[model samples]
Target: MTLDLYRADLGGRTREWLALHPDERRRRSVQACATKDVEALWSLTEAHLSLYGGSGLLASPHTFSAYRTGIRQFSQYAETQALNLLRLTPDDAQAYVLALLAQGRKIATVRGKVASASALYKALRWAGATDTAPFVGVRVPKDHEHPLTKNPPYSAAVLRRVLGVVEERLLSACGRERERLLRARTLLLLLAHTGLRIQEALDLTWEEVHLDEDEPFLTVRSGKGRKSREVYLSDRLVMALRLDRTLPRRRSHTAGMVLPFRTRAAAAKLLKPLFERVDEQGRVRSDWRGCHAFRKQTGTRLYEALHDFAAVAEVLGHADINTTRAYVRVGGRRAGKVMRDW
Candidate 1:
C-alpha cells in the first residue's frame, strides 16, 4: 500500500501516534513488531521519520515520498520470500542486494533501494521496535563510471535555441497563447541563469523577489533542507522579469506566486512543445530534461567561468561542495587551453 493509503487507514490514529508519550510509543512499537502487526509497524516507521529523522527536524515531504517508494519495493521482495521484514537477518539483506543485481538494476538504483530499507530499519530501531540490524555491512556494488558522464549539462547552443524558439512563438501568438509563451520564456531564462531547482522557482512569490535593489536578488524561503538562501539575479533574467511584469496576471504585485503555474507538470505542459521542435540540423534532440537541464547548464557555466566549487554551491544553494562538484563539466576546449599554457 502507498504511504498515504496506509495513513488513511490509520485515520485519527496518526495523530494519536504523535500525541503518545515517547516511552508508550516505544513499547507499542516493540509489541507491534513482536506480533508481526504490519499496520502498527508502518505507523511507527512513519512516526520516526516524521520526528527523529532529518537530524531531529521534521523531514521534508520529498524525503517521505522517497522513503515510501523504497520501502514499497523492499516490501514486495519480502512478500515473495515469505520473509518477515522486521525479523530479517544480515543474510536476507545481502540476498536482496543480489536479487536486485540479478534483475539487472543499475548500481545507483540498487544503492538507493538498499538505503531506503536501511533507513526503515534505523527508524524501527530508534523506536525500540527490533534489534535486528539486517542491513549492516550489506554492500552495494560501486559504479566505475565518472559522475560527469551522467546527466551532462545542456549546451549553450541548446539553451539559446530553446529561448529563440519561445521568442519566435511569442511574436505570432495573441492573448492567452502570448501570456503562456511569455511565462515560458521567463521561466526558461530564470532556470538557466539562476540555477534554482524547479520546485524552488515555482514556489517563488513577488514579495521574495527584489528587482528594484542595486543588485537584484530573490529569497528562497525554504529550499531542500528547509533552509533559506539568497540568489542574485542575472541581467538577462532581470530584463525578462521586468518584461513579464507588464503581462496581466491574476495575482497582485505584492502577493501570490511569481510563476503562473503552481506545479512542475503544468509548467512542463506549457514548455514541452518548445523542446520537441526540430533543430537546424534536422535532428530532433530527444534528450531534453525539461527545467533541470537549465539548472545544470547554469552550474556548468558558473564553474567554467569561476573555477570555484564554493561559488557554484552558493549559487545553486547546495549545502555540500561535493554535490556541487558533480554538476560541473570540464570540456576539451578548456583542457586544451590549460595544456597549451604548459
Candidate 2:
C-alpha cells in the first residue's frame, strides 16, 4: 500500500454484517492504498489515481489499464534521458512525447501521456515537492488531425432490443450468479441511459436511486475535480432498477456500497458485454463493447435527438460542454446518418 488515504480497510472481504454494502466497495480502491507511503511513493499510484480521479480529464473512465501503454512508452523514452528521474523536468516530458511521436502514436495516445504526466507532477507537488513541476511549460501540441468523436449512443430501438434480450438472459440465470448478473445488467443500463462515467456509475447504490417516480435519477458523489451532479434515468430504466433492487440484497456479501460490483475493475469485468452485443446494423456484434462505449453512445443520441452540446455534456458528466461538442463534430453526425437519416 502507498496512499494511506482510507480510514478503515480490508482486502478480499469487508467487516462482518457489512456485506452487500456498496459504500464499502467504493471505498475499497482507497483501502488498497491504506498501507501505502503517500509522501515517498509519489509516482505510480498517485499519478495514476489523479488521472482517473477526475482531476484533469474529468468524467472520463480513465483506467490505469488504459494508461499502462503510455507508461511503458515513456519508460522507453526514460532510457533516452540518461538517469534523470522521469518526474523531474520538461526535458524528460518532451523526450517522452517525442518518443511517442517517433513511434507514430495517435494524438489521443499522446494526450493520455500529457494528462498522466501532468497528474504525476501534481502528485509530486501534493507529496511535498512544492518547488518542482515536471510539466512546467509543457503542452499537448494542438492536434491538427481529425477530431475525436464520441462513439454514438445506440439507436433507441437497439438499446431497447439488446436490453430486453439481456434481461431475459439475466432472469433465467441460475443461483447466485443471477444477483451478480442482475446487478451488472442494471448498472449497464443505468450507464447508457444516464451517460454516467464508469466511476460515477460504479459508485452508485440502491439508496442513491429514487425509484418512487416514473423517471428515476441517480445522485453520485462526483470524484475528479470534486464535483457532484444528479443524473436522471429513463422511466423504463427506473422500473428495471426498482424491480431488481426489491430483492433483499445479500447482506452477507455487501459492505455498504451501492451496487453489487465494488471496485471499478470489478465493475468493468462484471458489466461489460452485457448489452453492447449488437452492432450499428442491428446485427449481433461481438461482446467487446465496454461501459465507455455506452457513455459515448449516449452522447451520440444527444447530438441526434436534441443536437444540444450542453445537454450531451451534462449527461456525460463532463465539466466542459466542449468535450461533448467535440464528439458531435467527429462521430455523432456519422452516427446520425447511419442510424436514422439513412
Candidate 3:
C-alpha cells in the first residue's frame, strides 16, 4: 500500500526481473494487466529502469537510490494530501512542488524530487498502471544562481596545510589508528592528485590501480553515468600508494579494495578532523566541501597545466565540458598572471 512497501517488494523482485528474457518480461507485463496484480505493476518500474535508465543494461545503484528517495518523498506528500499516485492530476503534482518549496527545499533538490516522481510515472505508464503522466510537464523552478560562485576549489596552500596535519597525526599514531590514518592520507592524496569523486575513489580496487606502470594510472570502472576512464597518477601519489600497499592490513579487511574504508561516510568520518581543522587565524569557514574540494583542486590545476577544457573533461570523466569548467577555478592570482603576460 505504502511506497516504502512497494520499494521493499521491488528490491526482492529485482534479481528475478533481471534474469527474465525480454520476451518473457513483455509477457509478464501483459499478464500483470490481465490479472490486476499490483505487485506485478510495481515490477514494471524496474523493467523501465533496466531498459531506459541510461546505464545500458541496468540502472546503477546510486541512480536507483536517488529515484527511490524522490519517489518516497512524493508518495509521502500524496498521502498527506489524500491523493492517489495512479490517479494524480497536474494540479496535484504542482501542489506537491509548491509544498516542497514551502518547506524551503533548494531548487535543485526540488527538481531531483520531481524527476524521481516523473520517472516512476513513466514506468507506471509502461506497465499500463496509469494512462496519464502527471509529472511529465510539471514546472520545477530554475536555479538562477551562477555556478562558479558556489563551492570554490580548495587552494594549494590549504591542501598543503591539511596534508601537513595528516603527516603530524601519522607520526604520533600507532596500531589500528595508525593504519586508519595511513589509509585516510592515501585516500586524500588520491583525491587531490586524481580529481576523483569520492564514490569513484572508494569504489577503486587494487586490480584497477597501476602504480608500477611507466605511465602510472588507475581505471575507474563506473563513474558518474557509468562511464569508465583512466586517471594517471602523480609520481608522489604513486610512491604513497606503493608505500600504502606494503603496510600490513587486518585479516578481516575486504579482499581487493584500494582504500580500507568500505563506505563514503566512513572515509568522511576518518578525514573530518583533518579537513575541519582551524587555520592560524583560528577562523573556520562555514563552507567546507570536504573531499570534493580536492577534486576541484585537481581540475583547476589540470586546467592550468593542460590549458584545454576537453582534456580536463576527459581527465575528470565529465560527460560535458561545461561541468568540467565549473570545477576549474581561475583565481585572482592566476588571472593576474595571465593579464600581466598580455
Alpha carbon lDDT of each predicted model = 0.78, 0.59, 0.76
The digit string of per-residue lDDT tens for model 1 on 235-297 reads 988988988878776755424677876667877887787777665899776547767777778
Give the distance in Å from residue 79's predicted Cα in candidate 3 to where it truly belongs: 1.2
Please write out the lDDT profile of model 2 over residues 1-342, one tens digit for every residue.
574333242221112213324454324323322323233233333343544454532433445445544444444455455534423566767767777778788767788877655664454343343346666677657776544332334456766776676678876797777777667667767777787777776666667777775555777765455566778888767766876766555555664556765567787677556545655788976544556667767777767788678877766767887677655553544677788945
Alpha-carbon runs more than 4 Å astray in model 3:
1-12, 15-47, 56-58, 248-253, 279-287, 331-342
**Model 1 CA deviation exceeding 4 Å by range:** 1-15, 20-43, 55-58, 243-255, 279-284, 338-342
Kindly provide the TM-score of model 3 when superposed on the true structure, using C-alpha atoms. Answer: 0.82
After superposing candidate 2 on the true structure, give the runs of residues whose Cα lies further than 4 Å from its correct spot.
1-40, 43-81, 86-89, 119-134, 144-152, 155-161, 248-253, 275-287, 329-342
Clashes of 2: 21
Q: Give all TM-scores, in the order shown.
A: 0.81, 0.66, 0.82
Worst 10 residues of 3 by lDDT: 2-11
